[model samples]
Target: MLLPIALAVVALGACDTGGPQIPEPPGPEQPTTPSQPSTPQQPTTPTPPTTGTTGAAAPPGTIAYARGGAIRLVNADGSSDRALWQVPNASLAATIGGLAWRPDGTELAFSSDHEMATSWYERDIYVVSADGARLRRLTNAPALDALATFPKGTVTVRVQNLTGDAGPYFVYVLGAPAPQQVTIPAASSRALTFTNVADLGNVAQPVVVINGTNRWFGDAVADVQGGRSVDAGSLVVTAFGGIPHYGADVPFWRADGQRVGFIGSPTCNLMQVAATPPAGPSQSRLLDPAVFGATCAVDWGPTAATADQIVYVDERRFVDAGEVQFFRVAESARSAGSPLLTVGRYPRITDVRWLPDGSGFLFARTNDLLDQAVNIHEYVFATKAERQITNFTGSFVRQFSVSPDGQQIAFERVTDLKGPSDLWVVRRDGTGARLLVRDARAPAWNPRLR
Candidate 1:
């Protein structure tokens, strides 16, 4: 028998319903004002654009979605919809959530609460073949182990923002020529990035300054490469800003997939860890000299030339509430260089996805003052021009993913925050929008198998 939609999906929300309640694990505290709203609304068909080519035929792959206690799959063309995994009756409140395709696409990894008693459940990772065979439990831990993905490599940096304003802040390695300076805006409160940075050991005294200001902050510099802080005061400080808030959010992967980075919470420092377990121990530091705000989204640039670079969005609340800026942090030499402000600022910008080739990216934004609808848009780095890709009203785009070929996009749309949502596909030029699936919450397309 089909179970009620598993609101207890371990990765999506609180896991206390229908089973023994487990205390949620600690992590980043996401913004509460605008959460990803689930809806039950019907899907809308999009009208094709007059000037662009029709949506390319559905890219070759499968899409995995969960309903009740089962994991299901459907081809990109909406064919062969079938169950991939179903929970056993032996376990109480057993439900599957979270899915990841093995790099070669031969297998899938997921998290589930199938071993729990009716009184309570704990999530664990498991791997199974695409054909639903060779199932193996990978973890039996006491804590949540959902949201599995393959790891990349490792790069680490220590970053902090000491100024008060949301700045286009510059970081200069002490005694370096003007050409060696790195610029990074406070990406919220404790926003940090790198450029022209070297393993300067004790010689690195990083000072930060905002443009058109005489005040600078860097009274304390340490050996960041060693991942330890020290007291060597050589920099001058004329002024300081009030402390900002810090909270955690799901971190984003670097382009090489070697390292994962997130804006640290409570202290607001920019933090990173190796994608996979590193040879040495991982350390955490609190660099909250002052508060910035929050930076919740990041997308790494594509292509070899752009691999070490990234594009992200962060908001500054008081300078006209809802102010958002898009930035690019590029790596030069040992330095990650400065954070370059890209294109235009908006009232809001979220859900950034880089184009397959790194020419630009796709993002979701609210164009009007009422912020009634969030539409998808394309921003080209070469032209610095932006264009709307989806123009539907009264609907909030919950999430979206780009097609492998980069010719199309798949997005979840909701007309009512309290209603159920559906999936839709559209062409790169904003044409040929059509409904793909109904009653689907998270739509993850399978990687193209070799």
Candidate 2:
């Protein structure tokens, strides 16, 4: 359960950097009072499962989402479009939220509704193949299941359940026959993790997608948690917990899947605390000294010299108002961060993300929207050059994610901030721009989308 809204945006805190660091200030640990509290009911009959196989091999990169009664997949170039699963009057949008692809690109998982549950938010979990075959329903429930994720280095995928009946909303990582349930109450929200999660996908680089609610929260799922995870062949910590992060939940699975980043105190600073996984009460420490009182936008980068570093936007108050500054730093050496060059005077940066290829990152300055309405830009670190990817008018690109191939980007655009939205994608250089799905909430690129 989430806390009250007013309590969520409060005073700044401290970070534990090993030796003698001050205790973290109590963050705004409030969950908003949901407008609609749902009723609890049992599951009606689930539609019979069906499996579709594609021996033709998925195109170099595939983009998929739950739509019009099925899971839809299309190429990055908008060619070869098809549905992996088709359910009459059922869709993943109701609960699953977005598309989660397996690491090997062999399977994909999402939440879909076959039966009308107590509320529209309640749905079931299903996994299908890259070719649309081996369709298996992973979960059957009477509660809400949203924000499904395939954490790197683990066999199981994590799913969220906003239970009715005042039951504790939990994050469950299912493997084999049973599920390892990690209940994250409104309290102890310092961090969240899944316990007993086994390996279901190829163990490449272990990463966990951390996302949350709030406006400036943006889409920073980046932040590499250093060391200790299932990917490392052992769990240094034990327990799993996290709060319900909404809207811009672009999952950043950093270093070994144990590291998770969170946003705090927007007024005092761009407050962020990196919670190391394995799940315990005291697991989270301030990533570094909370230098940037309101650290607005933050993205994680792997440094050859350092373990994991960050590029973030720090927003501060002036004599009369506020200001935003952009920087890149390794928390170990946080004495005055190395600043990144920007176009205008103090560009307002949000949704900072490293390109999949790691050459640079994509960010947006709402202030820039005045000259050019709603566009995505890339900042190349090697050359310190910024390039605009999307050139449009009057469209606010709310959230976006890059293809695993680093060739294309998917984003949600709307005329007004609260108006209806459509999902659009374009090439890295802004060549192929078109609409892929309409009225979509979260548009995530398949990890296998290369």
TM-score of each: 0.51, 0.49
For candidate 1, give the lDDT of residue 357: 67
lDDT of each: 0.45, 0.41
- What tens digits encode model 2's per-residue C-alpha lDDT throughout 1-450? 211112133332211100000112222221111011122221122112212112333225667764435667666555666666665444333333335554445666554444222111123334566777556543221122221232222332333223221223322222212222244332232133433333333212121222221111111111112232431221111122222221111223333223334332222222222222111111122244345444435655632332266666655432124345567766455464556753443343435666765677887655532443456777777777766666666556655667886766777666665555667775666654566666654455676635
Model 1 whole-model lDDT (C-alpha atoms) = 0.45
Worst 10 residues of 2 by lDDT: 14-23
Error of 1 at 92 (Å): 7.3
lDDT of 1 by residue, 130-200 (tens): 78866654322211122122121112223344445444444343222221134433432332333322333
Q: Highest TM-score among the candidates is held by which one?
A: 1
